[model samples]
Target: MLGATLVSAFSLAGCGEEKAGAQLQGPPPAPVRAAVLERKDVPLRYEYVGQTEGSRSVEVRARVQGLLLKRTYREGAFVREGDVLFLIDPEKYRASSAQTGGELAALRAKLEQTRLEHNRISDLFAKGVVSAKERDDAFAAYDSAKANVAAAEAKMQSEQLDLGYTQVRAPISGITSQEVRSEGSLITTDSAGSLLTTITQLDPLYVNFAIPGTESMQVRRQAQEGKVVVPAEGYSVRLKLADGSVFEQAGRLTFEDRYVDPSTGSIRARAEISNVKAQVLPGEFVRVLLDGALMKDAIVIPERAVLFSQNGPMVYVIGEGDVAELRPVTLGQGVTGGLVVESGLEAGQRIVVDGIMKVRPGGAVSVIPEPEAGGEGKPVAAGKEQSAGNGGVN
Candidate 1:
C-alpha cells in the first residue's frame, strides 16, 4: 500500500511537470490575411477572340446601259427601299416612248379600215354581188391588221418599261457606301456598272469567330460523359470590346460551321447581337464569351489562399477559437475571380488569403478584418493557368 501511494504521487508530479513545460513552449497565435468564403452559383464562361460583320450586305448595281445623268441619294447615307438613287437620261427614253405610241396609233387606223372593208365584202357576198375569193381576201386583211396592232402594243409596253428603268432605285433599306458612279459617268451593263456601291444592314450584327474543332469535339465528349452539363437554353454569348469594356447587348449563338477547315482544324461559329447604337462596327475584333451556363453550387477560393505541402494542394482553414486547420483541396480551374475549390472546403468557412507563411496546422491564428468592396480579397483570375485551357471550348 505504501509503495502504491508513492507510485501515484510520482505520476501526479510527472503530469504537472509536463503541463508546465507545454505552457512554456506554446507559440503565440499567428496573424493571417483571410477571406470569408461563400458558396454560390458561378458562370462557366468560355472566351474567344472574334470579329464582327454586318448581318446582311448588298451591293447596288446598275441594270441598264445609260449615261449617269444624276445621282439622287447622298453618298454614304442611309437609303430606304425603292428610294431613287440615280437617274439616267430620260430624254432619249421619252423620244422612244413617243415613237412607239405613234406606231400603235397608225396600226389602229389601218385595223379600222380593214374591218370596214371586210364588213362591206361580207355584205356583198350575202347579196351575191362579189366573188367568195374577194370576201376571203378582205377577212385575211382584217386578221393581219389585228396582229399588227398586237405587235405595236407590245413594242409600246417595252418602251415604257425602258423609260421606267432609267430611274435607278434602292433595292433594300440600308446604309449605303460611297457612290462609285457619279453624274455624267457612262454606266454600261458591264463590270463597271455592276460594281456600284455596297450597302450594309446594321440593326443586328453578326460576330464571327472560330473555335478549333478538336476543342469543340472535346466539349461534346464531356457533355456525353455527364461530366459537364449544357443548359437547356443552349449557349449564350457576351462580348468584350477592344477598349476592355463589356458590351451593353448580349448575343445568341446562331450558327456553327458544318465543315472544319483542314488547315486550321477550326470550325467557324457566328453570334447575332443587337447593335442598336452601332457601337459594335463590322470587321472589328472583339473578345467572345461563348459558354455562360451556370455551375451550380461551387466553392471559390483565392489562389494565394491555396498552398502546397507534402500532402499536395492545401488551404489553411480557420476554425473555431481561430484555430488553423490545413485541408487538402481539389481545384477546378484558376478563374478570373479565383481558383475553384472542388472539395475540402465549405461555405461560411474562413481561409487565409495572405500571410499564410506564418500559419501552421493546429495552431491558433489571428485573422485581419477583410476590407470592403474592391478590397484585397477580390480574386484575380489566372486566365491562362486555368485547367483544361480556360475550361475548354465549352
Candidate 2:
C-alpha cells in the first residue's frame, strides 16, 4: 500500500509538470507590419503609353528642275519662313529668262511697227489709195506680228517663274534636314525620288495615345450621363517619357477620335503640350496621365496589402484583438503605390502593410509602427492624409 501511494503521487507530479510545460508553450505572436488608416485626397489618374509628334511637319522638295548648285541652310538647323534652303543652278534658268526677255523686247518693237503699219494701211484703205489685196496683206502682217508679241510676253512670264523657282525657299518656319541631293546633282520637277529634306515644327507638341475600348466607353458614357465632370476649359495632363522621367509642363487633352481601331479595339486620343524649349520631340514614346475625376469617399489600400487569390482579390484585416481576418475585396483603378478598393473592408481597420507572408487568418498580430522608409517617414499632410485614407475604405 505504501509503494502504491508513492507511485501514484509521483505520477501526479509528472502530469502537473507536463501540463505546466504545455501551458507555457503558447502560440507564438504573429510577426506583422501595419499601416494606419487616414483620410486623404487621392487624384484619380490613368496612365497610357503615347508617342510625341510635332504639331506641324512638312517635307521640302525641289519645285523646279535644275542642277543643285548650293545648299543655303545648314542641315538640321532651324530656318525661318522664306529662308533660302537651296540654290539650284540658276544659270540655265537665267539664260532662258534672259532670252525670253530679249525676245519680248524685240516683240514689243515689232508690235509698235505693226501698229504704225496698221494705222497707215487703215488710212490708205480709207482713202482708197492702195488696192484691196495690198491693204489686206498689210493688215494680215500686222495681225501676225501682234499675235507673235502676245506669245513672247506669255513665254517671258513663264520663264521668269521658272527662274524664281531655282532658289528653293522654306515654305514654313521649322528645322531643316540634311540635303538629299548634293551640290551639282541634277534634280527634276517630276522626279519620283525628289525628296530634298524634311522640316518639323517643335514648339508646341502633340501626344498621341490609345485607350482600351472599354475604358473609353466608360469615359464616354459617364461624360454623356453628366455623372463625371471633365474639365471645361483645359483638362490637365502629365507626361512620362521613355526614360521614366515626368515632363515638367502639364498638357491638355485636345482631341479624341470618333472611331475605335478595328484591330486593337482602342480609341485614339491626342493631348497638346507646350514644348517651347524643344523638350518634347517627334516620334518619342511617352506616357500621358489625365487627371480630373474625384471620388468623394473612396477606400484605398497599399498595393502590398492586397493579395491575389484563386477565389478573388483579398486583404487581411486586423479585427478586435489584432487577429487577422481575410476579407475578399473588389478593386477599382490603381493609383500610385496603392489600389482603390470598391468593396469589402471598412475605414479604421489596421492592415498588414509589411510582413504579410508571416501572418495567417485568425492569427494573432502585433501592431508595430512601420519603419520609416529611407531616413525619415514622409510626413502626411493634413488634407492629403485624409484623401489617402479615404482611398482605402470609407
Candidate 3:
C-alpha cells in the first residue's frame, strides 16, 4: 500500500511541472508596435472622379445653301478663326451679286436724270413758266427714282453677304474634326441639317466633377468648428490619368454650381486645367484631387491599426498599464501616411501600427513604439510645415 501511494504522488508532481512550464512561456505577451498621435494641421483634400472637356466646341457648317466644290482644310487639322474650311461653288452667288450691281448702276443713272428734271421744273415754277401740276409731276417722278435706287442698293448688300458665305470659314480657332459633308455634296443653312464638321478648343481644357452636397456641408461644418481652415482664394486641382499617372500641368477651381442637383443631390464644380500641349483630350475620364482647405489640430493614425467591424471603423489603442482598448473613431478620408480621425481620439496616445493580429481589446500586450513618421506622429511647429497644406506635394 505505501508503494502504491508513492507512485500516485509522483504522477501528480509530473503533471504540475508540465502546467508550470506552459505558464512560464505564455507566448511572450503578444509583441506589437504602436504610434503616438500628435495634434497638427492636416490638409482637408478630396478626390472625385471627373471628366475632361474642351473649353469650346464649335460646329463648322455652311452658312448658305450651295454645292460644296472642295474641302479647303484637311480632316483633323488645326484651324484658326476665319480660316476657309470649304469652298462652296461661288458661281451662282457671284452671278447674282453682279446682277444686283448692274441694276443698282442703272437705277443710279435714272436717279441722276430725275434730279436734273426736278431742278429744271423748280426753276420754271419760280419764273411762273410751268403749271403747278407739271411741277408736282416732276417732283413725284424724282421721288420714285430715288426710292428705286435705295431698293437696288439694299438688294446689292444682301447679294454681297451671300457671296461671302459661299466660302465656309471657321467660326472659332481649334482642332477640326472629320468632315461630315464631303466635296460635291450639297450643304444647307438649316440649323437641323447644317453640321459640316466640329472644332474643339483644347488648349485650356476643363475638368468637370461633382461633389455630393452632404460632403460639402460637412467640410463647412468642420471649418466652422475651428478644425478646418479654408483658403481665401480657392482650391488647386490635379488630374490623374487613366494609367494612374498624374498630369503635368496644374489646374484652378473656376466655377461652382449655384445649387445642388435635385436628382443626384450633387453640386457641380469645374476646374480650369492648362492643356498647352494638348495632352488631355475631351470626354476623357480622370480623377481630380483638390487641395486648399486645412484640417487643423487633427489626430492621424496608421491604416492597419484600424479594424472594420459591423459597428463601424474602430481601432485598438494602448491605454494605461499597456493594455489594448477598443476605440470607435470617425474618419474623414485617407492622407499620405494614414487617415484623419474626425472624432473619438486625442493626441499623445499610442496605437498599434503593425502586428495588429497580436492585439485584442482589454488584454495586456508587449509595448513596441514605432519610429514617428515625418508627418503622422511628429508634431509640426507653427509655420514649420514640411510644406504648405495638402494643396502641394506630400
Candidate 4:
C-alpha cells in the first residue's frame, strides 16, 4: 500500500509539471478581425492638369491699307459679328472708285460705237461694198473695245471692294482686345501692321490636356483583356478650378490626337465645356477629371490592412487552418471604399483588416469576421488599432 501511494504521488507531480510546461511553452492564437474579399465591377476616375482656352481665338486685322480714322467699338468689350470696329481713311479709295467709274462709262460708249461700226461693215462686206480686211479690222476693234470695257469693270469692282474694306468689321462675335493701332495711325495691309485687335469666343471653352503613353497603353491592354470597360459615349469631364472649387458645368472629351506627342510622350486630348457665364477665363490652369471608366471584376480591400515593409506592400491573409500568410499585392487606383488589388489576391480569401499588427506569417489566428455595418470590427483581444481610411500608393 505504501509503495502504491508513492508511485501515485510521483505520477501526479509529473502530470502537473507537464501541464504547467505546456502552458508556458507558447501563447494562444492571435485574435484578428478578417474580411472575405469579393470581386465586382468598380468605377474609375483619372485626373490631369489642363489649360483653358477660347474655342475660337481670332486676330482681327485690317484688309486695306490706310490711315486709321477712328475706332468705333469700345476696347476690351464684347462685339458682334459684322459690327464696325475701326474706320480707315476712305478718301483715297473713294476717289479711285470714282475714277474707275468714269473710265468704265467712257469704255462702254466706245464699245457701243465699235459694235455699230462692226455691224455696218459686216453688212457692207456681205453685199461686196467693203473688203474682207476692212470687215476684219472692224471686228478686231469691236473685240478690243469689249476687252477694254471688261477690264475697266473689273477695276471698278476692285475699287469698290477696297472702299468697303475701309470700315473694318468684326469677323466673329466675341470679346475684343485693345486696338493695336489708335486713331490717326497708319494701318497697312501687311502681316506686321494689319493686326487691329484680337477676338476670343468664350461661350464654349476648350480644356486641353495630355495622357501619358504608358498609361494609355496599359488601359488599352486591360480593355482588350476584358479587365476594363471603357464607356461607349466617351469620358465625361469635369473641371476643378485653381481655387479648388469644381466648375458647375460638366464637359465631354472632344478630341484626341492620333499619335503620341514626341516631346511630351503623351497623347494630346481636348475637352469642350459650356462657359456661357464666362466664369472660367482663358489661359487658366485647371484640373480635369475623367470619369465613366470601369474596372471589371476587381478585388478591393481596406487600405488599413496593407502593411509596408522593405520587400514592398503586403497583407495578412488567412490561409488553411486559420494561419496567417503574408501576401504581396500590386495596387491600382483608389476607390471610395478601399484600394484596388491589381494582383496577388483572389476572391473568397480572408484578409486581416483590424489588429493587423498582431498577425505573423505562419502563426495561428482566431478570425473574427468583420461586421456588415457599424463597429470597428475589433477582436476581443485587440492588438494595435488601425483605421480603414489608410491608403496605399496607387
Candidate 5:
C-alpha cells in the first residue's frame, strides 16, 4: 500500500508540473525595429556611373613661330577670357614690324616725289614744253612708287598680326592645366603638337553617361505622355559624389543622343550642373539623381526591411497590435533611399526594420516609442509570445 501511494503522488506531481509549464507565459517579447509608411512624393531616379566633363575646353597654342620666352600665368590657375597665358619671343616680330613701317614711309616719300615730277611733266607736255615720252616716263615712275607703297603697307599689316599672335591668350574663362611646353621651348605654327596648356570651363559642367537603349525609349515615351515631370528650362538636378555625399548644387538634363550605339546598344545623355563655387571638376565620376518623375502614392520601405525568399521578395509588416505579417511584395526599380514596391503593399503601413528574426506570425507584440516622422530613431516592435499561430511561419 505504501509503494502504491508513493507512486500515485509522484505521478500527480509530474502532471501538475506539466500543467504549470503549459499555463506559464512565454519569454518577454523580443525587441524589433520597425518603420511607419507615410504617403508623400517619392522621386523616381535611375542611377548610372557617369563622368564629369567640361562644357567648353580650349587649347592655348602659339600661333606664330618663336621661342617660348615666358609663361605669364601660373599653370593650374583660373584664367579669364583674353587673359595672357604665355609670351613668345616678341623681339623678332617687333623688329619685322618696325622694318616694314620704315619701308612704307620711304615708299610714301618716293611716291610723293614721283607724283610732283609727273605733274610737272604732264603740264610741260600739255604746253609743248617737253616731249610726250618724258611725261609717260614720269607717270610710270609714279605708278611704280605707288605699287611699292601698297606692297610695303601689306607687309606691315602682316607683321602687326604676327606681333599680336606673340601673346597667347585664353579663349575662354576657365581653369587651365599645367604648361605642356615650358619657357625657352622652341615652338612652331605647324609643329603637329598640342598647345602650351588646356583650359576647361567649370562653371556650368557637363555630366556624360550612357543609358541602355531600351530605357532611353521608355524615358522619351514617358516624357511625351506627360508622365515624367521636369522643371523649367533652368531646373535643378542633384549629384551624388564618389564619396556618397549629395552635391550642394542641382543640375539639369541638357541633351540626349538621337541614335543608340550599335556596339553597346546604349544612348548617351548629358546633364548640366552649375559649379559656380568650382566644387565640381572635370573627369570625376559621379552618380546622377534626377527628380522629375513622381510616383503618386507609391509604396516604399527601408531597404534593410526587405528579405529575399524562394517565393519572391518579401517584407515583414506590423499589422494591428504590432503583429508581424510576412508579405510578398513585387519590387520595381530601386532609388536612392529604398526600393519601389509595385504591388502587394500599400502606403501608411508599418514594416519591420530591425530585429526581424525573433518574431513569428500572429505573435503578440509591443511597439516602442519612435522618433517623429522623418526623424532619426526608428520605430521598434517587440514580440510578447513565441507561440507559432495558425498562419504559416517561415
Candidate 6:
C-alpha cells in the first residue's frame, strides 16, 4: 500500500507539470502588420545615367591679327557682354587711320578750289569771255576732286574699324575658359590661330542622356495597348547627384533624337534646367529621372513586403481566417513608395507589410493594419487560436 500511494502522488505531480507547461504556451500567433490592396493610378518614372553640358558653348576668337599685348579678364572668370578680354597692338592701325584722315582733308580742300574755278569759268562762259571747252574742263576737274574726297573718306572709316578691333571684347556673357594664347603671343586671324578662349553659359544647363531603343519601343506598344498613359505636355526631369542627393531645381525635355544610334542602340535625349546659382557644372555626370507617365489601375505594395525565392518575388496574403498565405507575384516598375504589382494579386486583398519574417503559409497571424499618420494604432483582427508554425518561403 505504501508503494502504491507513492506512485500515485508522483503521477499526479507529473500531470500538473504538463498542464502548467501547456497553459504557459497559450495560443501563439505571429504578429504582423498588413495593408489592404487598392487599385489606383500611379506615376511611372524611368532612371538612366546622364551627363551635364552648357546650354551655349562659344569659342572666343581674335578678329584682327596683331601681338597679344595683355589679357584683361582673369582666366576662368565670369565675364559680361562687351567686357574687354584682350588687347592687341593698335599703333599701325592708328597711324593708317590718321593718314587716311589727312588725305581726306587734302582732297576736300582741293574740291573746294576746283568748285571755285568751275564757278568762275561758268560766269566767263555766260559773258562769252571764255571758250566752251575750258568751262567743260573746269566742271570735270571739280567732279573728279569730289570723287577723290569720297574714296578717302571710306578708307578712313575702314582704318577706324580695324583700330577698334585691336581691343578684343566678349561677345556674350558667360564663364570664360583659360587663355589658349597667353600675353606676348602673335595672334592670327586665321582659323588655326584665332581661338583665344571659350565661354559657356551656365544659367540654363543641358542634361544629355540616352534611352535604349528596345525600351522605347516597348513603352510605345504599352501606350497603344492602354497599359501606359504618357503625359501630353511631356516629361518633367529631375536629377540625382553621385552623392545620392536630389537637385533642387526641376527641368523639362528639350530634345529627343528621331533615330536610334546604330552603335549604341539608344536614342539621345536632352533636358534643360535653370541653374541660376550655377550649382550644376558642365561635363558632370548625374542620374536622370523621367517623370509624368501614369500606370492605369495598378496594385502596389511596400518593398519590405516582397520576398524572393528561386521562382520569383512572393508576398504574404492575409486570407480568410486571418491566415498568412504565400502568393507568387509579378512585379513591374517601382513607384514613389512601393512597387507596382503586375499580376497574381488583386484589389481588396490584405498583404503583410511588416514582420514578414515571422509569417508562415497556413499559419494564423495577428493582423495589425498600418496606422495612418497621426492616428491611433490598433489590431485590425485577432488571429484564431493556433500554433505558430515554422514553415516559410525558401
Better of 4 and 5 by lDDT: 4
The TM-score of predicted model 1 comes to 0.71
TM-score of each: 0.71, 0.73, 0.79, 0.74, 0.75, 0.85
Badly placed stretches (over 4 Å) of model 4 are 1-36, 258-263, 302-328, 349-394
- Weakest 10 consecutive residues of candidate 6 by summed lDDT: 382-391
Query: Candidate 3 residues 1-394, lDDT tens each?
Result: 9999999999999999999999886554456656667888877678999999999998887778888898889888788899998888889989999998999999999999999999999999999999999999999999999999999999999989889988889988888999998888888889865788999999799999999999888888888887789888889899999999999998899998989999999999999998987888999999998988888877778787788899999887778887888899998778766898878888867776666676677877665322255544444332121221222211
lDDT for model 3: 0.83
Clashes of each: 2, 16, 0, 0, 3, 0
Per-candidate local distance difference test: 0.80, 0.79, 0.83, 0.88, 0.79, 0.87
- The CA root-mean-square deviation of candidate 3, after full C-alpha superposition on the true structure, stands at 6.7
Q: List the residue pairs that clash in candidate 4.
A: none
Candidate order (lDDT): 4, 6, 3, 1, 5, 2
Query: Candidate 2: minimum summed lDDT over ten consecutive residues — where?
Result: 382-391
lDDT of 1 by residue, 1-394 (tens): 9999999999999999999999997887776666677766666777888998988898778776778888887887878889888888878888999998998999999999999999999999999999999999999999999999999999999889888888888877778888887789887888856566788877698999998898778667766865456777768889999999999898899898888999989998999999877787788999998765655566788787778778789998889999988999998755557887878888777777766787788998765443436644333232111111111111
lDDT of 5 by residue, 35-134 (tens): 6665555677777778999999987878898899989887778999999988889999999899889889999999999999999999899999998788
Residue 263 lDDT, candidate 5, scale 0-100: 97
In model 5, where do residues sit more than 4 Å from their true spots? 1-40, 113-148, 218-235, 317-324, 335-337, 347-355, 362-394
TM-score winner among the candidates? 6
Query: Tens digit of lDDT per residue, candidate 6, span 25-80?
Result: 75567777677787888889999899999999999999889999999999989898
The 10-residue segment with the lowest total lDDT in model 1: 384-393
C-alpha lDDT (0 to 100) for residue 117 of candidate 6: 100
Measured with C-alpha atoms, the lDDT of residue 60 in candidate 2 is 83
What is the overall TM-score of model 5 with all chains considered together? Answer: 0.75
Report how far residue 85 has shifted in candidate 6, in Å: 0.7
Worst-scoring 10-residue span by lDDT in model 4: 385-394
